[model samples]
Target: MLLAIDCGNTNTVFSIWDGTRFLATWRTSTEHQRTADQYYVWLSTLMEFLGIKAEITDVIVSSTVPRVVFNLRVLADRYFNTRAMVVGKPDCELPVDVRVDLGTNVGPDRLVNTVAGFDLYGGDLIVVDFGTATTFDVVAADGAYEGGVIAPGVNLSLEALHQAAAALPHVDITKPQRVVGTNTVACMQSGIFWGYVGLVREICARIKAERDRPMRIISTGGLAPLFQQAEDLFDDWREDLTMHGLTVIHRYNTHKDFRQ
Candidate 1:
C-alpha cells in the first residue's frame, strides 16, 4: 500500500493506494507543528473506524507548505519504515518535464497536477486548480509544464473583501440566483460566482489564443464542481487529481518502465 500526502496551504489530504486503486482518503486542516505520533494516532483512528487495514509500504508527498514536510517525512520514516518521496526534492524524479524560466521554482502541487493531467487526459492541456490561490498551469503536447497564470482564490478574495470593508460580512461562495442580486449576501455571491465564470472564460480563451492549438481545460480542487455547475468552465472536473498524481509518480519511481 502507498500513502500519498498532498499538503496544500489550507488542508492536508492522505490517500491510501493499494496498487490497483485507492482504498480510502482522509483530509485535515494543515498544521506544520503536528508530530509523527499525532499523525499516526489520527490516521489509525480513521482507518480503524473505516475498517481499512492498509500497510503503507511506500509514501509520496506533495506539499505546498514547506514547513509541514518534516513531520510528514518523520511519519513515513518512523511509522511506515520508508522514506517519504517529497516532490520538488532532487531525489524524487518526475516522470515529465517542467519548462519554466531560469531559477523559477515551480510549486510541487502544480507539477503533480501536470503529471496527472497528462497521464489522464493527454497533452496540450490547461489545468486550473482552485486552491488557496487559483492557478492556471499550461502543459505542452509532450507533458511538459509550461508556466501559466495565478489569481486570488474565491475564498481568499471573499476574506479580503470582508477584512477590507467594515460593512461587508464574510460570505460563502455559491451560484447566485440571478446576475443582479437583490440583497447584500446575494450581491456578494453574484459578484463571486459570475465574476469567476467570466474570469475562467476569458483566461482559457486567451491561453488558447496564445498557444494557437486545441487544448482541453481541467478543473480540480474543492470548488471546481461548484463553478462547473454554473457554466461549462472546464472540460472535466477531477476531485482526486492531485492524489492520483501522487500514485502515478510513486509508480514511476518504483518501476522505471511505468508509463502514463
Candidate 2:
C-alpha cells in the first residue's frame, strides 16, 4: 500500500492507496511542529478503528507548506521505514512538463494539479484551485504547465476585510439570499460569494480569450463545490484531485512507465 500525504497551507490530507483503489482518507490541520510520533498515533488509532489492515510500504508527499515536510519525512522514515518521495524534489520525477520563466519555482500543489488534470481531462485546460490562495493553473495539450493567475482566497479575503475595516465582523462565506444584502453579515457573504463567482468567471473568460483556444475548466479544493453549485463556473469538480495526483506521481517514480 502507498501512503499519499498532501500537505496544504490550511490542511493536510492522508490517503491510503492500494494500487488499484484508495482505501481510506483522513484530514487534519497543518502544523509544522507536529512530530512523527504524533502522526503515527493519530493514524494508527484511526486505522484500527476503521479495521484497516493494509501495511503502508511506500510514502509519497506533496506539500505546499515546506516547513511541514521535515516532520512528514520523519514520519515516513521512522514509522513506515521507507523514504518519502516529495514532489518538486529532483529525484521524485514528474510525468509532466512545467513551462515557466527560468529560475521560477512553481508550487508543488499546482504542479501536481496540472499533472492530475491533464491525465484526467485531455487537453488545453484551466484548473482553478481554492486553497489558502485561490490559484489558476493553465495546462497545455501536451501535459505541460503554463503559468496562470493567483487571487486571494475567499476566507483570506474575508479575513482581510474584517481586519482592515472597523465595525465589520468576520463573516463566513455563503451564497446570499439575494445580490443586495439586507444585513451586514449578508452583505459580507454576498461580496465573498458573488465576488468570487465573478472573479472566477472573468478570469477564466480572459484566459480562454488570451489563449485563443477552447479550454475546459476544472475546479478542485474544499470551496470548489460551493462556487460550482452557485453558478455555471466549472465543468467539473474533484475534491480529491491532489490526492489522486500524488498517487499518479508515486506510480511514475516507482514504475518509471507512467502512461501519459
Candidate 3:
C-alpha cells in the first residue's frame, strides 16, 4: 500500500492507497511539536482501528511546512522503516516545466496541485487552492508553470478581521441568506464568502485573457465546497488532488518505466 501525506500550514491530510483504489483517508491538525514516536503511536492507533497494517511499502509526502516535513521524514524512517519521497526536493520530477524565478521555493502543495491538474485536465489550467492562503496557479498550454495570484483565504481573512478589530467576532464561513447583511456576523459572512467569489472570478478572468485557448479551472483544498456553493467559477473540484499527485509522483520516481 502507498501512504500519501500532504502537510499544509493548518492541516495535515493522510491517505492510504491500495494499488488503484483509495483505502482510507484522514485529516488532523498540523502540530509541529509532535515527536516521531508520538506520530507513530497516533498513526498506528488509527491504522489499527481501520484494520490496516503498519507495514507501509511506499510513503509519499508533500509538505508546505518545512518543520513538519522534517518530522514526517523522521517518522517514516523510524516507524515505517521506509524513506519518504518528499516533493519539492531535487529528486522529484515535476511533469510540468516550472518557469518561475530561480531559487523560489514553490510550496510543495501548490506544485502537487499543478501536476495533478495538468495531468488530469491537460494544460492551459488554473488551480485555485483554498487553504490557509488561497493560491491561484496557472499552467500554460504547453504545461509550463506560469505564475498566478495569491490572496488571503476565507478562514484566514476572518481570523485577521477578528484579530484586527476587538468588536468583530469570528464567524463560520457559510454563505449567508442575503449578501446585504443586517447583523455584524451576517455582514462578515457576506464579505468573506461573496468577496472571495469575486476574487476568484476576477483572477480567473485575468488568467484566461493571457492564454489564447480556453483554460480549465480546478478548485482544490478543504474549502473548495464553500466557494462552489456561491459560483460556477471552477470547472472541477478535486478534494484529494494533492494526495493523488503525490501518488503519481511516487510512481514516476520509483518505477523506471515512468522516468522520462
Best by TM-score: 1
Q: Show model 2 residue runs off by greater than 4 Å.
A: none
Quote the positional error of residue 258 for candidate 3 in Å: 1.5
Top-lDDT candidate index: 1
Question: Mind giving the per-residue lDDT tens digits that candidate 2 earns over 141-259?
Answer: 89899999999988999999999999899888888889999999998999899999999999999999999999999999889999888899999999888888888899888888657
Give candidate 3 regions above 4 Å deviation. Answer: none
Q: Write the per-residue lDDT of candidate 3 for residues 83-187, one digit (tens) a residue.
A: 888998887777678888888888888888888887788888999999999999987777777888889888999999999999999788997899999999999
Return the clash pairs for model 3, or none: none
Q: What TM-score, over all chains together, does every model reach?
A: 0.98, 0.98, 0.96
Cα deviation at 88, candidate 3, in Å, is: 1.1
Per residue, candidate 1 scores C-alpha lDDT tens digits across 1-260 of 99999999999999999988999999999999999999999999999999999988999999999999999999999999999999999989999998898999999999999999999999999999999999999999999999999999999988988999999999999988898989988999898888988998999999999999999999999999999987888999999999999998999999988777
Per-residue lDDT value at 155 in model 1: 96
**Relative to the true structure, how large is the alpha-carbon lDDT of every model?**
0.94, 0.93, 0.85
Error of 2 at 16 (Å): 0.7
Q: Is candidate 1 or candidate 2 better by lDDT?
A: 1
